[model samples]
Target: MYLKDVPRTDPNIDPATLLQLARDVLETEAEAIRQLAPRLGEPFVQACRLLLACRGRVVVLGMGKSGHVGGKIAATLASTGTPAFFVHPGEAGHGDLGMITPQDVVLALSNSGETSEILLILPMIRRLGVSLIAVTGDPASTLARESDVNLDASVEREACPLGLAPTASTTATLALGDALAVALLHTRGFSRDDFSRSHPGGKLGRRLLLHVADVMVKGERMPTVGHAASLAEALLEITRKGLGMTAVVDADGRAVGVFTDGDLRRVLEKVDNVRTVGIAEVMTQGGVRIGPDLLAAEAAQLMERRRINALLVEDSDGRLVGALNMHTLLDAGVI
Candidate 1:
């Protein structure tokens, strides 16, 4: 039942008491995770090795609250270059055990080390010659002893006032699972590009995978003016493109400089007439150019660092190909 539906211990619960209890729960869970740090040695290393050497997907199995944590662990592993999926232990005892093959490695989770559904399928798992890794609170428990290697996820005590809930134990187990996933990630040499590929629909993917060309205004959409063009002509190009800047190209069509709204403001103050001034005299020489193949996020960082709003995109030959500004990267979600 929801907390609102459950009967209260007292008609009026003190706000101070509720806040203190919440703090205590957090403290207990934090301590439990800290205790796991000292226990990380050979068993943790063996687990990582098994995961790294596995020819097939890592199958995660657990029951109750451990099963919930196992699902998250499986997702974390899969996203971080490890091939993994969670299979319910209850379903595995039915027909889902077929999902586990001899080539696969099984990572099981159990606080008591004796989850019935998981233990029931242990013999079949062993028959398939699958390497089993257990995360358990009890090292001497049946599931822990039966496994090839056990990682201790034991916590001192539950955060519950009654001493029977799965608060601190679950937190410790989740933390251990995270530690395992991160360790495997580092061991696999998983890169940001690898992670972005796995999470293509997310914001990180957009920031990492998107290149300058993918988000730049190109061809007819790009604003450009010849080096010999008047300052007024460059202003027209900038207004037409609405990018606040225009690349000044030479006879060979290579970008030699850039004229921006900022330049116009400076020219308006110093030059007698904007129409009489040549674009080259007023332009910022080779203003903040970027390669079309560079990452858009890197482009954004460069813009922020240089304190400029626009960037001209050039080819390897220094030919003007496109142009973009802070707004372009923002539109592409690179910022």
Candidate 2:
């Protein structure tokens, strides 16, 4: 891929130099975040307190690259139990500032702590009596000085060779935002279940929320045979259902045992007359089973631990309610 515009000065730089520069950029950003850790103090606590006590949403305001970072911070906060949304500082000064209310808290981001767009709305935010939290490199700048709590996101230098881009500064600001979100998540006692609710379309949501019953074969689709049935009948049931196994149930419709292809191999080694042998005589009694309400992920773990490919789902009375094979979990994206 060739570019339309070339500098003509040495566009074909050595690959080794490019790789080293990339490594250096990563190191610089990492060091900036490391330096931000010890700076946590009372201001961080005050910010969390203000957010926790807020009755309305947290309105995040920023400009340029800081706006991008603020949007992500707001999303993380919202997904982790805090109500938040980002408002572009440029848009807010026009008409978006009306979104802010007395009950809402304002979180503003500015690498220079003097972004004109953000500073333009300070008087209106003050009129609303909304608490302001600032994330900035300059603690003494107007935005920081006016904020109720100012978080220092200063870095030693930019990762860019020209030291003109918002590289290390943006990384430090993002890390600080993540720190605040995580602290609030812990303080609010957020759980995996809560996270799953907000992310129901993702793989983690499926693993956490999908249950065995939701994916298991039930009713007429389940393979089962009577305990008094011959080995041939059990094998026929297993073949007809294609689950490689068949549940051996008592006359009362409760599972008494299970017979699988593994059992068939053992039975064939000794008993030549498969039609005359009762399934109960060779079946594994009370095979590993799970309840209908068990999470699919837990069932997957149980199958892996027991070294089995299938499981029976039973109800409170131990009656076979459903059956599931490893393929079921795979299809459901549980494993």
Candidate 3:
């Protein structure tokens, strides 16, 4: 390639300086995390054991940026089968401490290991006989020294060029908190069902989590027609129920074929007098359907892939006990 075709570097930029700065920042942060991995000795295991055994919630406390990380950690703990909540250190001194019980375990965070608000509540926490676990950079600092168990979250320096912003330190603290939550989760044998219980509003909770029985249509709302009925009768049933389709059933109330709006359109194109034809003659044999026991999410996938608007819900004997449409899934928020 010609020199003119090559991209020109900025005149003022020094590539070596930029690369060195990036390396230093990553090295410092990596060193902090590397230190934490081995520190998962008996103390860390004991901490997980304690939290797992606790009958009450885990109370987290921190100041400023640490507080934000603490909130996220608490949420992670709660969603992973551990009951926990973040208590602002400043607010804890002003009556929010009432939320904590003697049965609870307190996880306090402070980079300097000397947050006044956290220290202010130490005496009260002690009086309540609550277990105190501290996460701080200094092991010998007041908060760390006074805590029942201190987790060392020290870092060499901040990733910031000024060495003032809490970049690498906060990152290490958050990673440590995540490690603790996950370790406790595994120890407790927390399952996906448990997680879904804590997060019923999320998408994952709706998929593998929510049961089919919770969102299925039942009783008179279902559109159904006898298998021997005329095509006109099935169409009237579909129109009356407003489900765009009707379940064709046998004499024993079992599902046979399904007559949908699409079937009607195709049949109408072939024969102008579809009203006189028997529904079984024009209905789709072995149409796509679902059991009431199946997940609503699975039903939605089936409908989408098959390009169908409704499904005949059948029992083990192919009995048409219920019916569902795309609208049903939409209304239930299963889609």
lDDT of 1 by residue, 1-335 (tens): 22233346777866776776677779989999999999899999999999999999999998988999999999999999999999999999889999999999999999999999999999999999999999999999999999999999998888875667799999999989889899999888899889988988867889989999999999999999998999889888999989999999999888889887887887798988888889988789988889999999999999999999999998898778999999888888888
lDDT per residue (tens digit) for residues 195-245 in model 2: 888888868889989999999999998999998998888888999998889
What tens digits encode model 3's per-residue C-alpha lDDT throughout 103-205?
9999999999999999999999999999889999998999999987888888877777667788788989999999998888887888876876887776766
TM-scores, all models, native as reference: 0.94, 0.94, 0.78
- What does candidate 2 score on TM? 0.94
Estimate candidate 3's alpha-carbon lDDT, on a 0 to 1 scale.
Answer: 0.84
The candidate with the higher lDDT, 2 or 3, is 2
Candidates' lDDT values, in order?
0.91, 0.91, 0.84
Tell me the spans in candidate 1 whose CA falls farther than 4 Å from its real position.
1-15
Q: Which residue pairs come into collision in candidate 3?
A: none
Worst 10 residues of 2 by lDDT: 1-10
